[model samples]
Target: MASIPTILTTIFLFFLRSTISQQIHSNPDCTGRWIHIRRLPSRFNLDLLTNCSQYPLFDDFCPYLPNHGLGQKTHAKSHSWFRTDPMMLELIFHRRMLEYPCLTPDPNSANAVYLPYYTGIDALRYLYGPDVNSSAEHGLELFDFVKEQDSPNIWARHKGHDHFLVMARPAWDFSQPLINDPPIWGTSFLELPEFYNLTVLTFEARAWPWQEQAVPYPTSFHPPNLSFLESWIHRVARSRRSTLMLFAGGGGVSATPNIRRSIRDECENDTKNGTNGGYVKLCDVVDCSNGICEHDPIRYMRPMMEASFCLQPPGDTPTRRSTFDSILAGCIPVFFEDLSAKTQYTWHLPEEEYGEFSVFIPKEEVVFKGLKILDVLMGIPRDRVMKMRERVLELMPRVIYRRHGSSVDFRSNKKDAFDIAIEGTLQRIKSRLQEVAVL
Candidate 1:
């Protein structure tokens, strides 16, 4: 009974809704998804490094890019430039040395490049959607070649070739040469001998590990380094005009007496001793138990949420899980040490407001100096502590990552840190792309 106009409009609306749904559900094909630990199809699995002539090459150019190019930069020496006798059948290839970008907010734009290599299979799991496992081997080699050709190094040794540069910044330590001090083909980007028409495409940027000068990548790219910690520490120290605090992390390792003792001491000092320092605590009550203490969710998070100063001492090496917990608990983290938190979070609270959320302390100062805990406690002001606590609560959404299994809908038993990194990375990349000028 609908009129023609109304009927047409309804049809259009239905189509539009269906189109939007498809887009939302669709995942990137193998080309866009990064590689991980998966097998490639027999056709693409060919390691051109060892068998270059076996592949179909058009006037020396392979019809498809090789696999080592997908995830991270390949360091294999045998995959480098091909040494041929002009018959095209006897061509032998070796791994070409390539330079990946370093992590830096203000990277050297003049000649910097990115190359995603040694692709992680786990990272691409979501991109392939539910059927990712079936298509695991679909475009492995092409993706790898895409990464390699897009790299800035551009096979410095094999310059005069028609190839796309797979630019990606290294995520781990790849500078150690298996052979000599700069491997066979290992040459700087600027020093590479140019012999081809190359289009540079960047993968993700290299993270921490490269000192500011050692690598041409962003320090915040991979994770936090001593510098990131120092940056935050200096910020907090300047804002609160106080030394940062430390406490054991949560759960098994975190429920130690040191953390509880610190809490009690801080509460008593603030109440009776006129101690200016405040207290914030993070305890996953469900996971911890001592004969004397009862697990109370409200009690555990309340004091921390209300307190201006929270301690974020990491429980494990290489990462500070406490930083994530403290933020969600609504307390400002006084990060006095580095547990590689920066690697996990890059778009953390900004610098101007750094003091408003958390305080950072250098490893040298906190671990080596060994100052009295009381002296550190007395230094921070109560008023500023409250302000920082408020800031933390405000920034919690951006900082916390939720995990509720694979259900599209929210569920129980959530996991946090790793998911937070993925969300943060996506946001950062989106913001970065918006800044590019239209040509």
Candidate 2:
């Protein structure tokens, strides 16, 4: 019933709207997401690194603090690998925040607030000893300092919901158990009411979440620039993946309820049988018993580089650092459970189904139902596998933390793990703030 001009205008409007919708789904819109980073006292962050040797924990963290938490640079031939520590995520994130494009000095105009507190090292004092009084002393002191330092408009505006902090350790590291069940597991930093309200970024969040969001663990590979990252992707894509599976972890001795032992047993069985289950020499392994692979990365990296799928069973916690490491090697990850990664890294990785870039085999199916990993993997269509690998290459940059430098400009437009985290956090807070405004 409409005229030709009206029909043409309507069609054009529909096309424009559809194109905009596609763009919204493809590109992350970071409009009006200015972040105000609150300067915490040196004692909470840099001071902890200064006396890293005297901490209640393990190794001297002084060496890890240099190179902006990337750790000592390695002989990066094929990759920009580093002897990166898992304990320096706070600093890595801090450095990224320092170089963030939307960082604003005025808190009044800020959409979110960043609290760069090194809670991991600060909580190290309570990690070993059976002391509960000093468990959350640093965290409690931090809240007191924040209350004294910042304006009421910043934290008080949304009751710490808009404020976030990054801790290199998992939520469990700071979440002290109600009773001394383990006696010396973690500090009580996360247990406090003040910390509960703040949005926390961790290496691994609790499977059942409160406010903690899981980010990627620091892998050895950190490309200097986008071109370097692109080159790595192409190199790995072209590399011959002779092996089907790669596993790097301790062979569990306790056979009663062991995931690793089961995997190791199956892997060894497949390898030993020579041509079992319609496959030949299917799996490769890097024996990581006694923390060998943790220190020497190349042991696992070599195997992962030549493998198609990397088996990622739950370690001490639900997730392992090797998950990201395998991705760096262009190996598609095989997750045993949802909590391991499926539910953890929603922001950085794809938000759609996990099947796009990974293969998930339920742990129960393997442990109880007698599922053979090689059989399942070998059965997948080659085209699907290639598609998954291509998807992984596409997603490689999102999982990585690109090394920050002075040479790169603010609008360099390379979106890595840090950028993803910031964008995700800003959008999350924006929605929360809108809900608050509505109420």
Candidate 3:
């Protein structure tokens, strides 16, 4: 009894619904293609491991994990694993890429090529050892290898612009000048003109040349699968936060200003006075200088989960691995420097206002003017605090590097840090490719 137009509208609606359902089930985010450069000498990566015992922080750096560094069993009763030397991102990124679905064996079919050079670990071999010349030699060798590559390959295809290197250390570490009055730590690998156009994914990037992208520092929590990740998220969300704010770091020294010391002093002094009518719980500072602050996940994560805010000051560099860990624990980060998060991590953080997930107090206000840390955090409304915490939780997956060989499909809604980074890198390459085509 329905008119022709009514029947046609019903059929059109049904077809549209089916199309949307198909799109929802499709793997769109993991569509980028990449090829790993296997031509580099194995010695660059393998040589470091041959004498792993001599490397600095050997125990922290060289733990043999069963699942391709997913880590060994923390205990027989649970599936939880622990990893150290978050600076080992170069190794992990390379391993994860092999298993990444977007990786293609053929370079001709790829949009971007990855150079899996262990630049950080290799530098550590010489920087920490007695051989300074050996360090410089390593840098020269890598430069020569890339410079010698044939044309029509990934490096020459786009004049090294389409090629990328993932480094575990900050950009300054590799890009240090050869001649300087004060003599900085790092090699001249980044100083080569041949690498000017290449993209470098580093823990912290310098302000200039926009090709240096900042990725999340690796954290201790590598969930075995999606279920474990989901469970932790739920647990942290419901965890009763008893403390107003927490600071877990040693008193800063000469090269590093004593802002951390000042923060610790204020936190301890406030705790003694029973301040904020006993509502504020100021915890003790963890002495990192004593080696007690290394590789203990529970010690670090528990307090972060229980605290409303985690204080982040500049470490040896402006960035700290603890910033990402705080985000993973769903505790909102309070940064003292703009470079800590705002200026550095544009690729991973929200493009909109940062106030949605974090709080920033100028370093001078806290150190020079002697502003109260507890009072500042207490001023934020309870509802706003809840909203910030939620946003931090939402950002957890993007900051975490999931376990390699995990059964979880990255193309699904559960995209991890690796997924996000690859997608972003691919998109950048695609944009560059389009620009080149137009020119």
Measured over all alpha carbons after superposition, the RMSD of each candidate to the real structure, in angstroms, is 19.2, 12.6, 12.0
Q: Model 1, residue 254: displacement in angstroms?
A: 16
- Please give, for residues 406-426, the per-residue lDDT of candidate 1 as tens digits: 233221122222233323333
Name the candidate, 2 or 3, with the larger TM-score value: 2
Question: How many residue pairs clash (N, CA or C atoms closer than 3 angstroms) in each of the candidate models, in the order given?
Answer: 57, 0, 0
Evaluate residue 263 in candidate 1 and report its C-alpha lDDT on the 0 to 100 scale.
Answer: 41
lDDT of 3: 0.71
lDDT, residue 266, model 3? 75
TM-score of 2: 0.87
The C-alpha lDDT values of all candidates are 0.32, 0.75, 0.71
Clashes of 2: 0
**lDDT string, candidate 3, 251-283, tens digits:** 464454466866777766764333553444655
Candidate 1 achieves a global lDDT of: 0.32
- Please give the lDDT score at residue 166 for candidate 1: 27
